[model samples]
Target: MIQRIQSLYLTLTGIIGIICGLITDFIPNERIDMILLLVVAILAFISIFCFKNRSAQKNINYLNIIINLLLIGFMVYYLLITPGGDLSPKKGVELIVPVLLIILLAMANKYINKDEKLIKSVDRFR
Candidate 1:
């Protein structure tokens, strides 16, 4: 699995997701965003081991993408509704983390799909 590009992408996604959780202070006394990120990180990490199950890994990546999108939406909503004095441009940059993760997950999915197609093509020769 380590030899596959998707595995590397997935690993990076998990690591960065966790880092985003630790450093981003989107809200005071509330860690919903962090918790959501942690969940995604864990999902990505576990999916990496299932190299033999492309469909399941694809589904997990899809779920991770959706969750990351939802997390982005929720963060934006929270930032918009809260009082202006508490937020700044630097804080808004935290949204980039999810965006990056989305891109990485999409790339990983692309590679996974390629592998699936290759496996299918090979099986057709039997």
Candidate 2:
């Protein structure tokens, strides 16, 4: 499974998600954000082991992507409601992590689709 590029992408996504959860403190009531990030990380890790089931892996990635989009929306809402006239560096970092998660998830999905197509083509020869 590690041989596949999607596996590597999923691993990175999981790691980043964990790191973001641990270090993120810019938002009020950060527990919710942290929990969501951890959930995303767990999903990514689970998807990694489902390499034999491309459809399942793709579905998990889709779920992760949707969660990340929600996370991004929450971060944006928080940023807008913040009292400070200027945004803090940590706020920027917090927002960027979810976007990064979405990108990595999308890349993994792309590669998973490619692998599915390859398998289909090979099956056609039999």
- Residue-level lDDT of model 2, residues 64-104, one tens digit each, is 99999888878788777876645555455667788888999
TM-scores, all models, native as reference? 0.89, 0.91
Best model number under TM-score: 2
Each candidate: what lDDT? Answer: 0.86, 0.86
Any idea what lDDT model 1 has?
0.86
Off by over 4 Å in 1: 24-30, 86-91
> In model 2, how large is the Cα lDDT of residue 20?
74
**What's the TM for model 1?**
0.89
